[model samples]
Structures are given as structure tokens and as C-alpha cells.
Target: MAILELAIGFFVLAVLAGIFGARGVAGMSMEIARLLIIVFLILAIISLIL
Candidate 1:
């Protein structure tokens, strides 16, 4: 559930970025990718621990 939420958030952000961001789009995309990866890893770790 959390993972799905995070993915949807990432997708929405990507779409917004595509529409509005031109110069900083590359950096924004990379940062979003990194954030999503971190979120996934953290969720995985928590699930495993629980």
C-alpha cells in the first residue's frame, strides 16, 4: 500500500515535471528517482523487520 502510494506520487510528479520543468527537469527527475528508491528500500526494510 505504501509502495503503491509512493509510486503514484512519483508518477504524478514526473507528469508535472514534464509539463512545467524544462531547465531543471533533469535534476528533478534524478532527485525523484533517488527519493523513490530510498522510500522503497526503507519500506522493504520495515516490512522485513516487522
Candidate 2:
């Protein structure tokens, strides 16, 4: 849940950065958001298995 929240936060930040014309920051934030979401999914699956 926390990881998902962080991913959402990063996605929001990416959108804001894109609106402000900070392409680099926006791209980085988007990548971080993607990574966080993947991590969250992996953790969720592991928790369910255990």
C-alpha cells in the first residue's frame, strides 16, 4: 500500500513537472513511479504466497 502510494505520488509529481516543462524531471519521476508500482506488485504477490 505504501509503495503504491509512493508510486501515485511520483506519478502526480511527473504530471506536474511535465506541465511546468521540466521534461527531464518528469521522465525521471515517471520511471520511479513505474519502478515503485512493479515493486509493490512483487511484494504483494510475495505476501500472498507467504
Candidate 3:
């Protein structure tokens, strides 16, 4: 799903930012990734139930 892909992309961005020593950016990106993943999971569950 698009949300999952966005989460994965953000995860990769976080990793790269971390490697580059951008702690703030990395943290923000990782937080976004986590949120996206949670949203994706929720959507998937709702879709399944429906």
C-alpha cells in the first residue's frame, strides 16, 4: 500500500540522515515512519473487517 511505501521511504530517509549525523532530521523522519506504519496497519485492519 502507498502508506506502507511511504513509511519505508521515511525509514530509509531516517537511516541516511542518522548516518549523516542529522539527529533531528533522523528523529523526525523515524517518527513519521512509525506513524505511517501505524496508520497503514489500522487501515489494513479496517479494510479486512469491512
Candidate 4:
């Protein structure tokens, strides 16, 4: 839940940064968001399996 929210926050940041023309920050935020979403999904799947 928290991780999902964090990921969402990062995604929003990326979108806003991109709109503002901050390519580096947008790219970095997007990467971080992707990582966080992957981690969150993995954790969710593990939790369900366990």
C-alpha cells in the first residue's frame, strides 16, 4: 500500500517534471517509480503466495 502510494507519487513527479521540461528529473523519477511499482507487485505476490 505504502509502496504503491510512493510509486504513484514518483509517477506524478515525473509527469510534472516532464511538463516543466526537466528531462533528467523526469527520467529519474520514472525509473524510480517503475522500480517501486515492481517491488510493490513482487511483495504483493509473495504475500499472497505465503
lDDT of each: 0.70, 0.98, 0.98, 0.99
Clash list (residue pairs), candidate 4: none
Q: Give the least accurate 10-residue stretch of model 3, judged by summed lDDT.
A: 38-47
| Candidates 2 and 4, the one with greater lDDT | 4
Tell me each candidate's TM-score.
0.54, 0.93, 0.97, 0.98
- Decoy 2 TM-score against native: 0.93
lDDT of 2 by residue, 1-50 (tens): 88999999999999999999999999999999999999999999999999
Residue-level lDDT tens digits of model 3 in 2-49? 999999999999999999999999999999999999999999999999
lDDT of 1 at 35: 78
Q: Highest lDDT, which number?
A: 4
> Distance (Å) between predicted and true CA of 46, model 2?
0.7
Best model number under TM-score: 4
Off by over 4 Å in 4: none
Worst 10 residues of 1 by lDDT: 21-30
